[model samples]
Target: MKVLVLGSGAGGGCPQWNCNCAMCAAARNGSRLIRARTQSSIAVSPDGQRWVLLNASPDIGQQLRLQPALQPQHGLRDTPIKAVVLMDAQVDHATGLLSLREGPPIELYVTPCVFEDLTTGLPILSVLEHYCGVRWHMLPVAGEQRVAEFVIDGFETLRFRAIAIPGKAPPYSPHRHDPKVGDNIALEITDRRSGKRLCYAPGLAAVGPSEFEWMQGADCLLVDGTFWTDDEMITAGLGSKRAADMGHLPQCSSDGRPGMMDALDGTRAGRKLLIHINNSNPILDDDGPERAELAHRGIEVAHDGMEISL
Candidate 1:
């Protein structure tokens, strides 16, 4: 199994436009010690020929251009992407669906809530209605959804289990008035051909009991690292909420509490990585103290262009 963990930054990406933070500034100045990134996403392949995107990021075009395998060779019809596995309905994660509009109508697997969001407000289907070869498959949180020979098992995120801060909810739904909803999922995909497993959760809120079963067994686990310390934005005065308040449990939390790092380090999974990073996170500095701590825990921070074979 060949897996490509694409863009690894949070919603605004590392060097967020119009931000003058040290990290962003250093990145813009081409400092090797600092790095720039796009919104988070990943791609996997059973044979390295038929690729499946994990999420359609805002940076899809540049991401595809960086990967020769995904580039179309025979005009448009020869695109390699076979499907898209959506993790949530956030703009950064779903907006790039348009990048593939000219190619085949790719299979999209998402939960009911996400389906509603996509259909009612964004209407991704409508945007690609004229694009032949598109397909939409409704996937659920607790059941199996199959695509080709791959068996995809989904687990719900802590969107409902965790509280959403006032005025910090997704800009798309201000009232938060959906009938029955929450940010839909995280996924554990297994290739029947290779018998290898991958667990992907970019916008993770927290690691709950229900998700442990898959996390403990998967060969590779890509989890959220949106904030190195829970109060990152708070301390920086860039935002008024803690990482947890934003629906993402920080890499480490406040109240002197240990966070997701502990959960992942204690897990039995062989390969573990942290993704969906915030620009403010000190861990983004490869040689920073926090990065040393993650390394000491045997955790790998996901980086753009990083590849793993299972």
Candidate 2:
């Protein structure tokens, strides 16, 4: 199984257009320690020929331009992207679907609640229906039959299971008051042939015993690293909202409570990486103490264009 890190930054990305925060400023100045990044998204492939996008960010056009493999070749309209799997209905994760309207019909996989949210709240599907055909697949997130097996490029079969993680609905949704079973989820994908497993959860709000169990024995685990502390936004004076309120469990907590880093400190996973990083996160600075701390704990910070094979 191969995975490509298309974009590593959270919403607004590094060097956000309007902000002049330290990290963003550093990125704008071309500081080596602070690299510019786009909104979070990834591509997975069983074989190099065909790819499935994990999430399509608003920066998909730029992200695709950087990936030659996804570019057109045989014909004017040919593309390697075969499908897209959405983890949630957040704008950062789903807005790029609009950019793909010009491409050929694409399959989209998402939980039923997410499907409804996109159709009713955002109305993305309704808008896209006029431009191109979308084959929507219902992603199951509960019960013993949660795994959805599908063939990739007519050669390899991969199984994916969406595990419900603690998170609230997208802020723009009219049904935000009614959070459903699949408001947010972590995806566990396994290569049926090689048995390699990968777990991706870039919007994690909280990690409980069940969530930890879901990540056990994976070959690679990519998780949320949106904020260094719960009050990161407040401390940086970027916003009044806490990281927890934004649906991300910080790497560390200000109240001496265990955070994401502490929970994965001694995990058995062969590889653990932090993705979907926010511009305010100190870990984005290579020379920062937080980066050193993560390295010491055998964790890595993922960056755009990173490729991993398992």
Candidate 3:
């Protein structure tokens, strides 16, 4: 399995245009400790030739421009990415599909719940139908597929399953607060030839038994690192919601409560990394205590253009 961190920042990306937050300030000043980043997204390939994006961010155009291997080739209009697999219907995750509308028809793997949200509330899909058409592959919950397993084209070397996770859908969706089985998911992708597993859940609220089981012994575990503390934004004067309220499990402990680090004690993943980092998170500062703690624990912070192979 070949993995590439296409963009490592959360929704607005590091150094958001309208903010002058500490980290954003540093990023804008070209501080090495606070490198700029785009919205969160990743690409994976069983073989280097054909790639599939885990999620398409609004920065898709710039993200692709930065990675040569993902650029178009072979024809006048072409792209190395063959498809996109969405984890949820959040604005940051699904809006990038518009940037891809100029090329060939898009092939997507998504839950019917998310598909409906895009078709109605967001209308991204309904709009795309008039552009380069979309091929929707129903990404079923594990064990729900007719063949006992779902497969996407160009990904035969891998076995992947979407595990229903307890999370809120985007505010634009009718099921935003109601929560449904397919509103959100975490993916477990395994490379058949190498027996390596990758468990990805960038938008996480709380840890569940099933989520821990999926992370157990994974070769690469890329989980959420959106906020440093549950009240990060509140304290930073950025927002009023706690991390959990926004569907992200903060990395830091507060009020003597265990954090994501404590929750991951037994997983023992070969390599544990953090993804979808928010610009407000102090962990982005390489010299900060938060970052040092993660390093001491052997956990890496994903960065744009970072590559990992297993």
List, residue by residue over 268-304, the lDDT tens digit for candidate 2: 8999999999988889998889999999999899999
* Top-down TM-score ranking: 3, 2, 1
Give the alpha carbon lDDT tens digit for every residue of 41-73 in model 1. 999877777777888998999999999888876
Off by over 4 Å in 3: 30-32, 142-148
lDDT of each: 0.72, 0.86, 0.87
> Estimated TM-score per prediction?
0.86, 0.95, 0.96
What lDDT is obtained when candidate 2 is compared to the true structure? 0.86
Candidate 3 global lDDT:
0.87
- Poorly placed runs, candidate 1 (over 4 Å): 30-32, 73-76, 142-169, 174-182
| Alpha carbon lDDT at 109, candidate 3 | 90
Candidate 3, RMSD to the unseen true structure: 2.0
Q: 222-302 in candidate 3: lDDT tens per residue?
A: 989899999999999999898878888888777776777876666779999999999999999988899899998888899
